[model samples]
Target: MQQTPSVLTDQLAVEIARLGIVGESSDIGTLHRVTELACQAVPGCAGATSIRWAIPSGDAGERPEPLASAASHPDLAEVADRQLARRRGPVFDVVEHRRAVSSDDILVETRWPEAVNDMLSRGVRCFSTTPHVRAPVLVTLTLYGVGARALARSQHAIASLLVAQGSAAMSNSLQYDSVHRTAVQLQEAVEARAIVDQAKGILMHALGCDADDAFAEMRRISQTRHVKLTALAQRIVGDQGLPEITERPDRTTD
Candidate 1:
């Protein structure tokens, strides 16, 4: 028995949601999977390509930068690249306007003649670009068809649903990356501070001065030698020496 349209859509949604969970680890992986799934799920879709763009904050008018892209076929990838290279075609328009664009017959499409010719040469007769915005990121999913009017409006919901799931997954992945980076930086900072403190203790013992005086002396030496405080501290700890400071100068009151 053939499956009903509702059953097919439900299954597609479930598959896309599963990708969301599995793809949380990688934004690019989500995009690649979405393109592959689009070809399999969307009716009349011969091939698919997706572009992920980073929208700059506080510049609503600024053009978004392309972050990543994936395509199901080489020809489809080439078609999308040519559009980006020329800054024209349905992808560009859809991104700029934040709306969907479609061409039923590229052979006679007037908006982007050159792009149409390129697609025709690559055996793409029709295409649709749909934008999915997920704040700080905008993804455009383009579906390619081999016949005129092959892409029907009836299947647009399926494509949109796929892009939405992909966008959510990408957002979650980016957040995870950012948090991981911040955590690493914080760990490095803590390690650096600990080393610096150890170096100060060594200085206090060698110079017979207080912590503040030792730190001040270390800073002075660091400035004169053009070496980072952390590097100087590490050297002091390793060598167990005065770091070339021969005499213990009078502590200044400040």
Candidate 2:
């Protein structure tokens, strides 16, 4: 689950390592690199952006999961977001259904009539969403400022590999997030626990009980009152009164 790539995968590894892209913090760099590399490696792939559909992890159902975008280009991200909101673009559908999505002719997919028309209006006619091997993830390589006919002359394998690498990078990013968060939580827990131990020592001295008994007493009260251990420690240490709990803040983007 380490995001580090092997030496044999030297090509991509070299680029990622050069950018210092190890995890979610490196997402932007990863996106930019993917697009640049994809364009160079795959024919007719004017550019690519890392994009995800209907990310369950997104807060408030507002932002499009994570997309590998070249930049904070409003036109590109807006089109992608609109397609998802409209639920009518092949990119969204492919990512949502976890399938290889291609449109040799976007006009043929009747299900996305409204969305397709809108896309055509943007001067982008043909595109595809290739499923990343480490999926539930997808990459949509948009061939724009050019016609889909150009894609017909290109190598299919190269395109597939471009998407595959993008997927791997995305999955690795997620795994990095998991590990980073676990570490932060472990540190926080240890700190909170240290304080709790201090408070327990105070109680143990006051009540003449053993360490185990003191800890057990804290657990009993926390469980009975349905409060978290850290919160309890705060109250006992700072004498702060307990109040309502708010939505947990997302530390990923933060």
Candidate 3:
């Protein structure tokens, strides 16, 4: 049972490295995909991946969200998600509590009532979790098998490597997403300003007015037309081309 998955882990790493997430943003969806791969690498995994960080669960806030996962069974996945939301389960808490949780008999682990119940219902017998000590990063590596005692020592090592790479991938993805969003916003603003200026040019020529007067006129048209000044300017530059000052509408709603 364990022999095949250990080999698969090395093969999986080669495949995962080709994913090209280094020094880049890893989207939530990509993280989910990698987690699914981890589940697949292990023979007995029931196809579930959990990636969560330990946030300060205080007297006043809900726990963290399930950052990403791709589970084979939807119901079991929901149960795992809820456990994360509550901040009271083995996967996240083991890391939070700074302890290793290993159980051959999940039925007797009173500390994890909901997780144990969920595992039993899902036919998952042996569950083990190790705390990942990447500070301020609440990452835990989990390994479990259906109707079994514990993962082979080799399997545990394999799971650790998978989780480590997954963590790095997720971190890079977030950074890239932030940068991309900022760049898009900047581009949009620059484009909007360019349209406004072109509209201003058209107004100045058509109305035979100063730059300030042309802008005020554009704003007036925008308000009157119930459209953005940028849009009005774009229309002046693009479609109907800048219209006559006489084309400016009244700004009164009544």
Which number leads on lDDT?
1
lDDT of 2 by residue, 1-254 (tens): 00111122467546534433345345556556655555555555543445533345555444336444552234555666776566556666665566665666665656677767765666555665555545445455443323554444344555566556655666677777788999999998899878898767755665566787666666766887898876786676675632332222222432
lDDT of 3 at 89: 78
Report the Cα lDDT for residue 124, model 1.
85
TM-score of 2: 0.56
Query: How many clashing pairs does model 3 include?
Result: 6
The lDDT of model 1 is: 0.83
**TM-score, cand. 3 vs. native:** 0.68
Ranking by TM-score: 1, 3, 2
Model 2, stretches more than 4 Å misplaced? 1-21, 24-29, 47-50, 54-81, 104-116, 119-122, 133-139, 191-254
> How much does each candidate deviate from the true structure in C-alpha RMSD?
4.0, 11.9, 5.6
lDDT of 1 at 42: 76
Model 1 TM-score, 2 decimals: 0.82
Better of 2 and 3 by lDDT: 3
* Cα displacement (Å) at residue 15, model 3: 2.2
Which of 1 and 3 is the better model by lDDT?
1
Evaluated at residue 152, the lDDT of candidate 1 is 84
lDDT of the candidates, in the order given: 0.83, 0.56, 0.63
